[model samples]
Target: MVQLDLIELADLVRPEQLVAEILRQNPQMPVPVPLEDLARLAGISKIEAFTSEGFEGALIANATKSQGAIFYSNRGPRPRQRFTIGHELGHFLLPWHRQAKFQCTAEDITSGGNKDWEIQANQFAAELLIPAPLVKTRLQKLKDPELAHIMALRDEFETSMEMTARRVVELSEYACAVIFSKDNVVRYPVWSPYFTHRLCVKKGERLPAKSPSREAASDPDEWHELDAHWWLVERRGEDTPESVYEQTLVQENGHKVTLLTYDPE
Candidate 1:
């Protein structure tokens, strides 16, 4: 194993660059990237379970010591725990991450705040778990971006469907978006760069009346064609309407994920 000082490893600003460098160093690194092993290799002395409430995980260190322990909530699901470990590792490795000790909440790990460090850490975790190159190859081979495909990716990658879906949108060539909602209220949406349409609904807004997400309560995992305007804010004076493919999946946790793909035809 190559000895990488914090400063040497932390120069990269982008998560992709960091992940690429990590993989470059450990060319034999396997899929599902053994985060705990990487943590240990990167100066983490131990990964222990914590019974703390509110916080998902934290990094323990001081100015004097480069190595530290990682603590994660024992109650979180295994997948979430893995993500938390990766998130804390990012905080440890990134030179720009100034906090010697970090206590991250669920939202900090998931929704990622406006703070640069939090966003970078979240990106690092996501890329480390589901490397963009692998995800891009998988997306290219898929005939259709269905809920089942996302679920399969989740299982194969040992990650949450939400994370897998977000990765799909981030790397896919198709114009697509994944909207997550709880109790019919939009929580957040991730969109592919090629997706030109702007989502009309904002966070905390109810699912549009005409949206297939509205039918998720009755018929989950169903796909339907919707008028683009139903989801996307229309361009002023534009008369032509495009068709958007919509699929809704109701998670066991009661969160609804609606996958939207624009017609490429």
Candidate 2:
């Protein structure tokens, strides 16, 4: 495989653009994108397994060259490992990511950070793994977003459930958001442009009393309509409608994903 330099890759400033260029160049690339193969083709010398304690993945460049090797944890699930590899590859291909080495933790790969490079790399990995165009098409076919639909999309894309949920929110026609929490505390929330209402909860905040996420502890995968005040803050004197729906799914590890949808009418 011929080594591809930054100039040869897309010159776009955003991660999504870079991914679009890659897909344009290789129209036949299969779903669940061939990350390892793409890495090798993009000048990654080796994809080695690491048993690191604190970090999920690392990209180390040679002292005299720009090309390097990618090392990912062998202990994480396959989906996670694939995402890590794609994230590291983003760091490798991004022109401004000039660091000779990068050691990234699980949070670095999974969440948006204050650093510009980390955010760009995450966007890149997401688009590479679950191309937005394809996701948009699939979402258009759904009459309503459901936990089962999200799970099926995750399995079809061979990506993490959180990733799939986020994509669903991004592409949904209705005002929607996906909240990830652990032990009742909010971790992060991803919402769509149409979702104008502000979420009352913030990172580390406990779930609202009437939240389906709280009920999910007992009945793991169920959808229910909760009072709007339970999750949204209404403006003074504004009439709050009762069309808010929430579905929560609890994983075996106690993490919860709550999908919120609102109907203004």
Candidate 3:
């Protein structure tokens, strides 16, 4: 069993470093080896597809610290499968994650779980697919921040819109955030601390009416900004008043991105 301080390991292992370590362990491994191969390198051998009672996937037992089981339902899109596998792998590798099994759902991968581990796993997955340094260089080269640019990065990194949006929000300087909605209701929103305190969209609540997201036939490609009060609830007794700007991206596939901004007052 390899000994590692989980927190220290988390901090020490950059995505590239982890990938390189996998390659070193599996010398004959193919470049861009399938995610399964990486899992095996981490001591997970059994990859089974079955119907999960309530979880999308799980990793059961790691006594040897070199072998475990990975299970996922044979459902959903390929990206979702990849995400589930990645999520389980995260549990297996994180030293602090000690459980007989880890049960994860679709929302669990994106929205559920404690904030720190969820964020850590998310950061791990993001770094594994799209290294921050490379994305930073790309953002530097392309000064214009547009939805089209995000699509380009998605292609370049071979990741989903959600992954690309999170990284973009991190790299972008213009007080931006990404709000995901389903059936016209907000599911989760990720924002920078600068813009967090002022954001008004409530979880599980319907989107604002005046926003382009409410339009019957809205173009997901364009961005439109509106006043802060349109989305945020007002403070009843606060002395200082604040406002936010919103940009909407209604994906043709049904997902939405609401980019919120605030003028540095």
Ranking by TM-score: 2, 1, 3
Give per-residue CA lDDT, model 3, range 1-265, as digits (tens).
2222233344344444554444344444332226776677567888888786687887797564456898877876665666677777777776556565777776677755665555555555655555555676777787645667777887766677777778887777555567878767898877654454445677888888777776656555665666667765567664222555555666656667766656654
lDDT of 1 by residue, 82-135 (tens): 889989988887777877899999889986877788888888999898888777
Q: Is candidate 1 or candidate 3 better by lDDT?
A: 1
- Predicted model with the maximum lDDT: 2
Off by over 4 Å in 1: 1-10, 62-65, 216-221, 236-241
Alpha-carbon lDDT of model 2: 0.82
For each candidate, give its TM-score against the true structure. 0.88, 0.88, 0.69
| lDDT minimum window of 10 residues, candidate 3 | 1-10
Better of 2 and 3 by TM-score: 2
Q: Give lDDT: candidate 1, residue 79.
A: 83
**How do the residues 144-240 of candidate 2 rate in per-residue lDDT, one tens digit apiece?**
7788888888988889998889888888887888899888889899988888887888999999987767754644356688888888888887666
